[model samples]
Target: MAPRFTVRYFVRAADAAEAKARALDIALEQTVEIPRDVVPKGYVEDEILGRLETLEQAPDGRPGFLATISYSEDDVGGDFLQFLNIVFGNSSIKPGLKVEDIGLSPGILSLCKGPRHGITGLRARAGIGDIPLLMSAIKPVGLSTAALARLAHDFALGGMHYVKDDHGLVDQRTAPFSERLKACVEAVGEANAKSGGRTSFVPNITGPADAILERAKEAEAAGAGAVMIAPALAGYDVARMLAADPDFSLPIVAHPAFSGANVVSPDCGFSHRAFYGVLHRLMGADAVVFPNFGGRFGFTREECRSIAEACAVEMGGPKAGVPAPGGGVNFARVPEMRAVYGKDVMYLVGGALLQEPNLIDGCRRLAEAVYA
Candidate 1:
C-alpha cells in the first residue's frame, strides 16, 4: 500500500451510525465521485477510494462526530490543487461537515517549499528579535503613485517594521502597479536611510495569473523587502510558486481577502486554523493575515487565537509563520493584542492609524504602544 495522508473532520449527524455513514459517504464523494459499488475493482478501489480510519463522538460534544479519513498520496497526483480537492473539494459544498485538521505525508511536504522567510527569517530581516513585528497598509486607493509613496515613507519613518499596499490597491490609472511599486520602494528606502531602521515595503502583487510572477520580479528589482498577495484571489498555487522559487527570496504575506466563506460557519467548510494558518503556511506564507476578533468581520476570539496557534504550532517540517491579525485593528488594541498573541506576532494596523490627525505621529504612537 502507498503512503497516505489523513484528514480529520467534524461530521454532523444524530447518531454514531449516521456519522459513520456520512464519513463513508465523504470518502466516496471526495474521491471517485461515483457510486462505491460502481467503482472499479482494481486500482480505483484499492488506491483511489478514501479509507475511513475512525468514527467517534466529537471532542467538543457539538452534536457531531469526529471522522478520520485517509487518502493515498497517489490520488493527489503530486499537485497542490488536487491535494486541496482531495481534502475538501466536493464535500465542502455539503453542510454539517467541517475540516478540523490535516496530516500531511512526506510526499505532500516534498511537493511544497513551505515558508522561505517564515517567522525567524522575517524577524531577522526586520532586525528585531522576539518582539512582535509592526506592520501597516497604505490605502483608501484612488491615490496617485506619489501620494501613496509619501504614505509609505511616513509609515517607515514612524517606525513601522513593515509597510504594505492595501489589498484594494492594484493597477489602476490613478496609481499603476509599476509606478506605485517603484515610488513606494524608493520612499521606504529614503525613510530607512534617515531613520536607520530596517523597515520593509511590501507591495500587493495580486493580479492576472500571467502578471503575478512579473510583478513579483519587478517588486524585487524595485527594492521591495517583501510582497503581498491575496491567495484567495490570485490562486493558492501562485503563492506556492513564489514561495518555492529561489529567485523570489522576499517574504510572501498571505492576505485573507476572499477566504472568509471558508471559515465563517461552525459546521461547514474549513476551520479557521486550517484555512488561514496551516494551509497558508503549507503554501509558503511568511505571514498569514486574517480578520481579528472584535473587528468588523465578526471572527470570534477563540477562532482568532486558534489561527495564531496554528501558525506557530509544530507541523512536522514546515517553518512556523507569523499570524497577522488585522481588519479593524487599532492603536488602542495594542495591549489586548499583546496579551493575546505574545511577541511572536505581526501587529497589522491600517485605517485606525489614518484616523489620527497626523499619520506619522499616529504610527509612532502605535509603534510605541506595541514595543512598550
Candidate 2:
C-alpha cells in the first residue's frame, strides 16, 4: 500500500446510519467526485478514491459524528493546492462538515519544507531570550508613509520586537508599498541605533501574485527584518514558496485578514488549530496571527488555547511557529494572555498602543507588562 495522509472531519449527522452515509459521501466528494458506480475500477478506485478510516460519535456533544478519511500520497502529486483540495475542496461547499485535524505522512512532509526561520530563528533575530515577543502594527490605513514610519519608529524605540504594517495598509494613494517599506525600514533602523534594541520592521506584502514576490524581495533589499502576508488574501502556497526560498530568509508572519469563515463556524470549514496552527505552520508561517478570545471577534478561550498548542506541538519535522493573538488586544490583558499562552507567543497589541497618550511610552508600558 502507498503512504497516505489522514484528515479528521466533523460530520453533522443525527444517527450512526446517517453518519455512515455522510462519510461515504465525503469519500466520493473529496476524491473522484463521481457516482460510486461510475468510479473506475483498478488503480483509480483503489488508490485515488478517499478511503474511510473510522467513524464515531463526536466527542464535543454536538449532533455529529467524527470521521477519519485517508488519501493516497499520489493523489496530491507533490502539489500543495491538490493537498488542500483533497482535504476539503468540494466537501467544503457542503454543509455540516468541518476539518478537525490533518495527519501528514512523511511523504507529504517531504513535499513542502516548513518555516525556515521558525520560533528560534525569529527570537535570535530580535535578540530576545525565551520571553514572549512583542509586536504592534502601524495603522489607521490612510496615514501617509512618513506618519506610518514615525509610528514604526516610536514602537521600535519603545522596545517592540516586531513592528508591522496593518494588513489593511496596502498600496493606497497616501502610502505606496515601496515608499512605506522604505520609510518603515529606515525608521526602525534609526530606533535600533538609539535604543540599542534589536527591533525588526515587518511590512505587509500581500498583493497580486506577480507583485507579492517582487514586494517581498524589495522589502528584503530595504532591510526589513520580516514580511507579513495574508495567505488567505495572497495565496497559502505563496507563503510556503517565500518561506522555502533560501534567498528570502526573512521570517513570514501569517495574518488572518480574510480567513474568518474558515474557523468561525462551529460545524463548518476548519477548526482554529487546523487552519491557523497546523496549516499555517506547514505552509511556512514563522508566526501565525489570529483573533484572540474576548476580542471583537468571537473566538472562544478553548479555541484560542487549542491554536496555541497546535503551533508549538510536536508534529513530525516541521519547526514550531509562533502563535500571535491580536484583534483588540490591550496592555491590561498581558498578564492573562501570558497565563494562557505562556512564553512561546508573540503578543500582538495594536490599536491599544495607539490609544496611549504617548505612543513610545505606551509601548514601553506594554513591554514592561509582558515581561512583568
After superposing candidate 2, which stretches have Cα over 4 Å from the reference? none
Query: What TM-score, computed on C-alpha atoms, does each candidate reach?
Result: 0.98, 0.99
* 153-269 per-residue lDDT for model 1 (tens digits): 999999898999999999999999998988998999999999999999999997787989989988998899999999888887988988888787899999988888899989698
Residue 36 of candidate 1: its Cα lDDT?
Answer: 80
lDDT of 2 by residue, 322-363 (tens): 999999999777878888999999999999999999999999
Q: List the residue pairs that clash in candidate 1.
A: none
Q: Model 2, residue 170: what's the lDDT?
A: 90
